[model samples]
Target: MGRKKVLAVIHTVAYGKRLLEVLSLLEADFRLQVVFTAPPHAFGDDVPAFLARLGSVVLPWAQATRMTFDLALAAGPRGVQYIDAPLITLPHGANYLKRVTEGPNAGVAGLRRQDLLPGGRLPAAVVVPHHAELRELARDCPEALPLAHVTGDPVHDRITASLPLRAAYRRALGLDEGQKLVVAVSTWGADSSFGRFDALLPRLIGELPAPRYRTALLVHPNVWAGHGAYQVRSWLARCGQLGIGIMPPEADWRSVLIAADWIIGDHGSVSLYGTLTGAPMLLATSSEREINPSSPAAALAAHAPTLSPTHPLVDQLDYAAQEYRPEEYAAIGSRITSEPGRFNRNMRKLMYGLLGMGQPAHEPVTVPLPEPLPLNAWAPGHGEVSA
Candidate 1:
């Protein structure tokens, strides 16, 4: 019998990297074709090359209208099953295309209600990142079937797998021994009207007592595009004048994060990455109105030292970090890390079922949470690690 074909549609490089990683792991079970919205550039350039290296056929769809419908039509006649990962929503131009061109057996992975119709029927199965994301999806869209919550994000799994090269990474970044590194990551929409980073950045940078650690300010591409690189460079110049060694915003942020002793940022997926690296995360938000607390990013901050510029929750931050042990971190990590394999297996089974083939003999993998780690040891000097 011929191998079943699957079309994995990834909207961005981050999500593309993730889907590609899982596809690589499941390569033997099915024929995979990757359709991306655009070819990666600048910081995201590594993703497509990485996917190509994994031996998948990569197709770039550039025009929004043609990209959505044409790609689906091209894949459909070839008997390819469709899967949407993370942020590939049904709204925008894709919605009409999805309805017109999608094969009968199309599915959505990591789907949430906000990404679909208000009363829409759930797809074949929903892929989630963790229990937290699953809970949020359930609360928001109860109709969706919980096909699986893969413990690990493919991107994170790739990141964690590279941990052994830390020393070499540190050397490449030009870091000296014993000089502590702190990474401050900027998020998209961080400069919106509700965001007070103009005031917050200066205060945060001023508060950092230097010579103890070197700070790297990693600006988001969106922010750079909005304000321009020259503006970011000028701001970093001001930060440097204040004694903070601002790492160029153009550097590969994942590598920078890997080399950091700590991370400070607004709530984002990067915090989850920080958790995997065993780095202390200091979350800096502008105000409660600026972010949704129920968000996956916020949920991550709830379990860590999240600080808001306008509303200081210092005492709560201190207590949470001190109280939660390292074993707890390990437990959380394990819970989130175990999901990828199960997701891959289920995806394979779903494709087979859609193809009218007998269900694959794939079993879902369950990963037990690890014991909490000692929080006190990593907590005390944590304040000095953030901007």
Candidate 2:
């Protein structure tokens, strides 16, 4: 038989980057194609580009509508499988029904309840990173099967590899040799809940004693694009006015992670990477409960200090993240760093399994898989599976 072809549909650069890393390890076993919803326009576009250059076909998101299920069905007959990486459901909340019914690309677009049906015709498998997400998907689309919960995030792996030389990294970034570095990776949200650094900026600046520690803020591309360069410039100006040495967002954040003495940010996989790198980290929670932490994110928070409005340090700095007791953080952190190869190995297993190559023999790590919830429990209207 010929090599099995696999197409990975990813919604963002981060997920695409992880897909690429997994594909890179399995290039010898299968033919791979990577489809992205947009170009790599984020802080970590390098990984995505590298993967595309390494023989993964890039399909424009706009052009995807023309192909439809017909294309996937044709490919399936030839031993090709379509895999949708973790995708956020569109039209979130009350607007969901109205938006799906009225959108230009409405009526059974992308991966939906109908696609997972026995003869409805979709890919052989769909890969979701977190069990909570998988449970939600299963509840909404019962026909879909639960694949392995492969926890390996390429971004986390990249960040982990850079932690050892953090001191040298600090010196290279021109921060004072003795001063500790605190890095904050901001996120973009519809409400000001996650991205509002305006209140926290001045307070964090005041908390750090000049020449004792310096803070570097790495804003997500979505936030920077939405707020513009002027917002960042203004923040930098304020830091300068307060005698704080602000490091401009010029370097790739993975390298910046290498230089960081401590990290603080809203819930995201980046924080998980920080934990894997063994960086002293903190999480800023969302007031609106918009940002939900993944398993790894929760695992990392279990090890690190979580800053919240109630903490004593909350008054010292105007940021928000639930504090993780010292013992919890240490326990979780130790487990993550103990087996560096667990993530890579498991990811390889999932990729190979999707291609029907059977599972490879590998030592298993004690990563717990959360219980899968029934589909009917979440969305009652989705019971009629697509035929």
Candidate 3:
């Protein structure tokens, strides 16, 4: 045989990023031929720009499906069902917690019967973060049970590995010593954090003491894709001018989550991940049916305090901090990944096993996230400047 071939499918900004995290494990292997395809998605913005920076030529979707590969990897189900190769479906976020709010396939986010076990056909494998997800899969798509594997969460692993670098990450963001970072995080759709507390963005500037607090935003990549980056940035321009810096979708958000002292978010994956920061989190919004009640995101929502607009935002932030106990967040954080640091190893082993290839000889390494860039460094666009 010449060499094994692999195809990476980019379904959306979120799915693309998750694929890269897992693909990083196979990067050093020269025996593999890998190419990527940006599949059509409702939110496909920035995917081409993201893939272009890697200096790899991306195969167009139509051409990609025509070619054969040893294995295909996808974080979303968008175009993977058509690929003529063994496929692995990875999680784009925490535990497939979000329910699909619309469309015919709309049901549980990840366990859509038509998507995973289309016409009673199963993907080669479906990798979930925890065993709890297996129960979810059983309830939703029992046909996928045997195909499911709990290799743990790579995103969680990266953050767990990078926790000690918190101080350095904070400094990289240009935070003054006394300033506590408050991150406003939101997932896309009408039930997200910004969807509810959008007015709170402007309020952050007026409510909190500037010297003691630094505000930033971590908006879901899909939101940026749905609303053009220019428009998203423009909408929040005034808030940006006041103080809050927006974390670009492509930036290593784990670093920002690491640096945060408070997390004001909804039931998004980031809030679930925020548990690791030991940063007290306040849910900016909550909808009865937006998330699975048993999912980790729900566990977090059930425990974390809701942000009350009637109360002073600062007082809520203060109360969350003063009443904070590591054990509480730690319990929620534990639900994220049962295998923790084993993600890289387990994933590598599973991929190599499927590819029928041998593992590399070198010791495994988890690269620490690089320092974050300043807000001004990634200005949404370079407006015309006077010479």
Task: Give the number of the best model, judged by TM-score.
Answer: 3
Each prediction's number of clashing residue pairs: 16, 6, 0
Reference-based lDDT, residue 57, model 2? 60
TM-scores of all candidate predictions against the true structure: 0.57, 0.56, 0.94
Model 3: per-residue Cα lDDT over 1-387, one tens digit each: 587889988877788778878888887788988888998888996888777766666999999979888999888776676788889887888777778768876778878787686446578888988888877788878889998888988888888888999999888888988888998899888888878655777668888887788888888888888988998888888877776787777666778888999999888888888998889888888766788777778778888888887899999999999988899889889998888888888888888888887899875577777777764454542211100
Which regions of candidate 3 fall more than 4 Å away from where they truly are?
100-106, 380-387
lDDT for position 285 in model 1 = 59
Local accuracy of candidate 1 as per-residue lDDT tens digits, 196-277: 4576566546555555556666655445545654676675566656655444322234556677777676644455456666
Native-vs-model 2 lDDT?
A: 0.43
lDDT of 1: 0.44
Report the alpha-carbon TM-score of model 1 versus the true structure: 0.57
Model 2: lowest-lDDT 10 consecutive positions: 90-99
Question: lDDT of all the models against the reference?
Answer: 0.44, 0.43, 0.81
Worst 10-residue lDDT window for candidate 1 reads: 91-100
RMSD values for the candidates in order, in angstroms, are: 10.6, 12.4, 3.7
